[model samples]
Target chain A: MPELTARAAPPLAHHFVDMRQQTEAARLGMWLFLASEVLLFTGLFTAYSIYRYLYAGVFEEASRKGVELWAGTTNTFVLITSSLTVALAIHFARLGRGKLAAALLGVSLLLGCAFLGIKAIEYANHFHEGQLPGKFYTFAEVQGPGASMFFTLYFIMTGLHGLHVIAGMTVLAVMAVRAWREEFGPEHYAPIEIAGLYWHLVDLIWIFLYPLLYLI
Target chain B: MPNGEHQTALEPHHGAGRYVAVWVALCALTVGTLLASRLSLGPPWHLLVALAIAAAKAGLVALFFMHLWDQPGVNRLVFATSLVFVALLIGLVLLDSATRFPLANPPNERTLRFEPPSFETHVQPGEREQGEPGAIGRPPARE
Candidate 1:
């Protein structure tokens, strides 16, 4: 039996006809917000592309010389795994397994912290090495123009991403609290669903960021 | 807006096992992309290959993990429309930058050249003097 018709329409916000309509509106709203988020990141991506194009060789050398490739790969794995856990959390929420969902979200939140921890280590390494962006850049390994530009884009893109991680963790924490309180169940887990979507978006951005910043 | 019942019917209830499967696939693709970067394809091919793999991984997360696969078409269109506009933004910038004349481009060590010597500079031995008959870029001498 489908869960949709299992009970009368869950609590409504006055305008919605039923629970289904509410969920649809919630999802649509989230997607639209995601679209705006995409555009926000596109500006940084465009800057990265333009700079890389103008200084192809310099960008390659700077990335090779300054970046810790293995660290980046580790963070990539961490974020992807967290994405999996968060998805599982939502699954549990929909099944009315409140404790299990809460636990999964807790793990996801911890992994996000781990990611930021690793990122801080990387940032400290760069700072100590004088790999600052633009005029502040002083690393001697890569010489000539555009080296600073690489780090500039690097810090800006990853810095913004790190902020998103923090934001997602906060949202997940809220979801975890609600799950523990039994606020979400088989029929009323839309908040968890949307939070999961936001966390996935964080992971999705890192998916692209990994290649653009670390690999190529 | 569709009613609650219709949206509920549309909701997919794929089990945790299926989500795990997508997760495994995403991890494999990540490894594939990392290895692909090590290949010596060079330039656009390497970049394109890596981005293609990333896009594949992102698509999996969006469709399965984010439940976009179960959502209505309007939701999908909103997201896809954003991507189309992004493409337009990047495409226009590249078009403008890629078609400029070489001299008009940014100054870099790659484009530097030594200035050509003028006619007043010391001429090599056995070279015709400036203004001499048949000399290039010199006025013809009176017969």
Candidate 2:
């Protein structure tokens, strides 16, 4: 219940020894959370590797038929750009430049939306071409053994990623609102940084996904 | 100072330029991976190269953008542990596949059902089978 000077530091929780300890603890918790997230995605990646190994030819052909190169690449750029903006937002938030941070966050949110928009377009294309998962798949270009399995894996992996994008966008929106309200500053912008970490993870997942689903 | 509370400097060197530079590198790498995929590296090498580029890109984002470089050792360890486990999962499965007979691979279910089963043989016409196994190639009821 000690009164802190205006320029000193944010009020630390009762259990924390110092702002440094508290921040580190919070950050470590976030990293652990991220680690768990990585583990969750690992299951899908394992499924992908096993299926790809078993049905190499069918998977490769399905990649070509089910996914559009231009759309996937465009979304990749969009997501990577969003990661940069989020990183910059965190950078500015640490400098106590709330407006700049908010602006950059806004940009990142737009790019996130744009990525989803492109994904939706790709999904629509899949629907039109009858390239669906499992038994619903009707695409004739790549039919036969393991064909449905490829689309099944494709829809599951990317669909999960798309959901993450939506979640990231929602988080960015909340952060953007807070940043615009000047809630973050040099002494206390850990939330912004943590959210940026999350957004970057989303981008990171897509970076690998682009090549795996679209290219190889 | 204030109630024996330790204060850490929250402000690091704010370099927008570094972020911009990293962003450029990431984009260039994306394009590079795309170009590499277009090459006829063939089979394992093609996959290996593409994955290497992805790992590099993921590292750049994690170390630079996610501030893992500045993060404490504990956080880094936690992250690295996650990656190691992923490697373990993939590596062990791949090793099993590589070592196993081609037809004996765990995922190769076709070997179990290589021949199409006759449906008519499982259930006779106008014969109401009670408590008997329904599927073909299955053991008879043990009454």
Among the numbered candidates, top DockQ falls to 1
- Candidate 1 residue lDDT tens string, A1-216: 232344444567889877778888998999999999999999998888777877888888887788999988999999999999998888777766667889999999999999999999999999999999878889999988788889999999999999999999999999999876666655677899899889999999999999888888
Q: Give one clash count per candidate, in the order shown.
A: 2, 0
Evaluated against the true structure, the overall lDDT of model 2 is: 0.82
Residue A195 error for model 2, in Å? 0.7
Residues B7-48, candidate 1: write the lDDT tens digits: 454365776798889988988998999899888587889889
| TM-score between model 2 and native | 0.85
Task: Name the Cα RMSD for model 2.
Answer: 7.9
Clashing pairs in 1: A20-B4, A21-B4
Off by over 4 Å in 2: A1-9, B1-7, B105-143
> Would candidate 2 be rated incorrect, acceptable, medium or high by CAPRI criteria?
acceptable
